[model samples]
Target: MRLSNKLSHALSCAALTLAATPALADTVWLKNGDRLTGTIKVFDGGKLVVETSYGGTIPVDWKQVKTLESDRELMVKQDEFTGERAKSLKAAEDGKVTLINGEAPKTVELASIEQIIKPKPILEDLVWKGNVDVGLDYKRAETDTDDYDVDFKTTARHGAWRHNAEGGYNRESQDEVTTTNNWNAEYALDRFLDEHWFWQGRVSYTRDHIEDVSSQRTIGTGPGYQFWDDELGAFSLATLVNQNDYEYKDGGSDNFYSLGLKWDYNRYLVGKTFELFSNGELGKPIGGDSEYELDAEAGLRYKVTDWASLNMKAEKNIVSGAKDGEIDETRYSVGFGVGW
Candidate 1:
């Protein structure tokens, strides 16, 4: 009798624990009489994202939802109102939700909800993503030739400010003679004035080991406009007035003012398995020996997996009408890289 009672008590406790585990999760009912239990991530763009232990992150069509319940304080926006941080969510009638806000529960239609977002800390919600690519070539036996290149770009965003940094190095040697050798780095900071406008400050430096123009530096400030930034793509354009300085190996140097235009664009296609991107700057010297300067690159990235990609791009660099004559070059490269 004692043994049977002990076993019965153990089974009862186990059953209660199993039942309570599911009550901790939010619940959603579909029109097809199916029920889903998970933590609601967000509802945006006609999709409700949920984090589930069984299916990972899943996006459900908003139209198929009958009702939903949550115990989370989520930020929700309606068609004509700003975001409201509700205290919790409780199930209501079909196609309606009860927002528990400590006073009276406000009922809203699901169709009128424009967006739902989880609130995150301002300082703790920084986003960092970047890519690193490398290319190499080597040949031997007849004419000794070697070429190596490395390039990297990173961006970080916090609140209203965006930071960008990129740099690259390239070297080529044929017949024991170095034909091309240079490295450059640049950093730019942008502060958004609003959703579509911003102000920027930037500084850049470049050094060439085997060229007449050995050193170059620039400082600039500008205003910019952002077209759109979302899950699919981003694009921005800016104009700057810059102070440029150039130094030559022939004991010569020049400094002048220039107006420059810059653009950045990227798009994802084929269900985000491929991306197309281009960014560059063009400068017209106001008063200098250099007539026009151009630096640009356009590329395509094919995602092999979530974290790895194959990249191909073409780059052009020119400083025309310089003291050492026109300097023009174009390069094509294929590389392997990783991105986050």
Candidate 2:
């Protein structure tokens, strides 16, 4: 009896190990009654890229796919014309996926599918993307002149939360006299409620000796909407209520409140080799001595490689209720930088 029990226990352990192992194959059924088993790499431009053991890599039109079965969870979205509905789903063997709603499993068709992306770990999902640009010039003459400018931006996303940080500095000197020197930094965090709606909080600080401003700081929060977000272009708008603090070069300090409206837009053209973008904020005071403020930038970028680009940009900045000779400033810069 002891030997028989040992054999049964060993068999049960073996069965549990087999059940816990991940499946090694993914299957796709075609409309023409043909089936293929392999690993799906990605889906883009209405094409599904798959790697098979027999065939190296196959590009199948999204329309030709009848059904797909996989053991991994993936993100699925519908076509653009259909409101771009999206969900996270896990597939079973019989070409069906169970949605998060706990409803009965539903069959999905290829025609309605826009994208299928594999799941990533929480830490792996925090991907940062942006660029930097710098410009410098120097002239050695009777009186020496030097100018330097730098701009940097980065954004990261994980799940429904996104974070962005940006900063820039510019300075020029002639004959040991500072002609222009200014710098600014901003940070923002956004929480997404859906594909097109988000809530954001922002903080910014600026110091500009050229404009006679020692420092200006702001904190704000608001809701935003993505009007268009696709390969061709994107646009977003938001309104925020902000508290602003100011310190002047002449030894004065003040605080105020404002209603701020902001706009961000970008476009990619010519096979995505060229990009144009603009963003701006306008603020009107609510109950303080401050009047109105504006900050804006527009830029164009030309891609030179996968990681580098050439850029030209113009910026405008203004603040109300500043000390004498401190109101507004503008500058233009051209440089090259890298991004992901």
Top candidate on lDDT is 1
For residues 176-250, write the lDDT of model 1, one tens digit per residue.
999999999999999988767899999999898887888889999999998865444678999999999998888
Query: Candidate 1 at residue 98, lDDT?
Result: 86
Instruction: Give the local distance difference test score of model 1.
Output: 0.84
Instruction: State TM-scores per candidate.
Output: 0.73, 0.68
Model 2 per-residue lDDT at 146: 89
- Candidate 2 error regions (>4 Å): 1-107, 110-127, 231-233, 320-325
lDDT of 1 at 200: 93
* lDDT for model 2: 0.74
How do the residues 307-329 of candidate 2 rate in per-residue lDDT, one tens digit apiece? Answer: 79999989988776643434777
Compared with the true structure, all predictions reach lDDT values of 0.84, 0.74
Clashes of 1: 0
